[model samples]
Target: MSRLALAIPLLLLALSAHAEIVIGLVANRGVEETRLDWQPIADDLGQLLNQPARVVAVKNEAELLASFQRGEIDVLRGSSKVALSAVEGGKGEIFARLALTGRQTQYRSLLLVRRDGPASLDTLLAHRQQYRYASGNPDSTAGYLIPQYHAFVRNNVLPERFFRSVTVGNAEDNFRALVERRVDVAVSNTDDLPKLAEKYPRDYQQLRVLWQSPPFSYDPLVIRRELPAATRSRIASFFLDYGRNGPDATRAKEKLYWADQLDGFLPATNRQLREVTDLQLYDALFRLALMPELDTSQRQSREKLLYRRYDQLTALLGGAR
Candidate 1:
């Protein structure tokens, strides 16, 4: 064969070898912040797979879903809500769970009030209607979903119906609202509290935990189902083995911190996300029950549906601990 013919095949091989893989990062912060946080992980994955990998920060679940639908993202790291949504939408499959540094694989949602404001949880719950509240985005697990389910559906006290007002934002925004006295209570997660304290000790000191939800599992790392089986295996193995063993184990742990405060990734399956799926189902049913447009009959039907699902999920989740 001529040299030119050989070069043509070599060029094709090089092109195939460097195919770009886009990993969608859940935007807990601004796009730039998310990019900076996850870049190390992206680089590490690229090195491990010998492929060009990049990170894409999605502002919310909607944006993440859109990206998946457009086939723009090949990997995802996000809350269980986002991961389950992707799987249900036929976009991805849960392959591993992200464990936070010092937190392991479980965390909880917290309700916070100024230390001087509410002396006790009873005091806060007693006059709940008189105070404003700040919660995380609607899609947030610890910040919104878990708290809402615990405070509203489980307790039969809906903030929307009883609180003075309810504002939705990110963890930092909600915590800032609490510290600034913009809202009387703020919903955040166990992991975020320490970070907030570390960054704003004075403000964090002003806040006290009023209540906390039961421990919830860490978010899962999802891979696009469309990828080749071998490629998927490589991706799964990379995360599962990261920070666990090898000469670069220490460096891998450090890199995880740079990639969104993670300690490491643990091997996980879709079955491991069962509880989160149950939570999501319960949240949706509760929301349906609150639909103002529903008539008496419709509302009753929704209530019945909600109760049925609540029982089913509760049972599946091992009777809610």
Candidate 2:
């Protein structure tokens, strides 16, 4: 009996070890939104690997970067913007870029307000003193970071000085705040709109889009660099072979909204990642140049920082030789 007991405990431990994997989700929006939308993908991963997958939704860019650096997560799924930054920092690599139906770029942001509330972006800009503004995460592409950088920073509006409030949260929370009359302006994504509208008809009915940004690039499924190459290959193959299991696989495909997502996972190199990374760096530099907060002295300091980064980037891209 004692021998049997020892064997049983060992077996249980083996099973437990095999069943656990920690994943980091980009918490660009709210934790609830990330969990709710990506649960199916997580579940699918678990079933494929015969393991239980745990997802940690990280807030803000710094948190995501830190978690990735510490190897706390096995995979990261985020927009091209976030993925690019992570890649630049050497924390991960793109295993696959997502697509849906005929769409390649899921990056989009719409400036919105309550349907009965706002007339236009121009009118809102003119009376910017009258309303509150909610942003998604400061690092979020379609959410806060990009839109704000484009609007107030590029246009020299200075959000805090002009708007009543500039709050940050998930896209859902931003929209909800608008619906609840807590904020007068919020930014959201086009990819998420149909899904959100279907989920909350009343809220959708009350909102109106003031403007939409041009499409940029799609999100990427990033793989941790520490994982063994064979293991990485196996996981990539598993994800790419989604429909081979008949009905369950088909159902899984629809649930995760990968009907038209890439044909399969592809081997990605650091160079591929550099494409998006460079874009974000330039975008940040542009914002810094246009920032309203910087004085002449501050501008010179900012210019120094920008030029230093530009030089480093050029060297990294093999341009400084």
| Model 1, runs deviating above 4 Å | 1-17, 284-321
RMSD of each: 4.3, 5.4
Candidate 2: lDDT of 20? 60
Give the alpha carbon lDDT tens digit for every residue of 140-194 in model 2: 6667556765655556676777897888877677778888999989888776666
TM-score of each: 0.84, 0.77
The TM-score measured for candidate 1 stands at 0.84
- Tens-digit per-residue lDDT, 109-181, candidate 1: 9999997787765677788679999977776677778888886677667778878999987778788989998
State the weakest 10-residue window (summed lDDT) of model 1. Answer: 312-321
Clashing pairs in 1: none
**Using alpha carbons, what is the TM-score of model 2?**
0.77
Best by TM-score: 1
Q: After superposition, how far is residue 134 of candidate 2 from its true place, in Å?
A: 0.5
Best by lDDT: 1
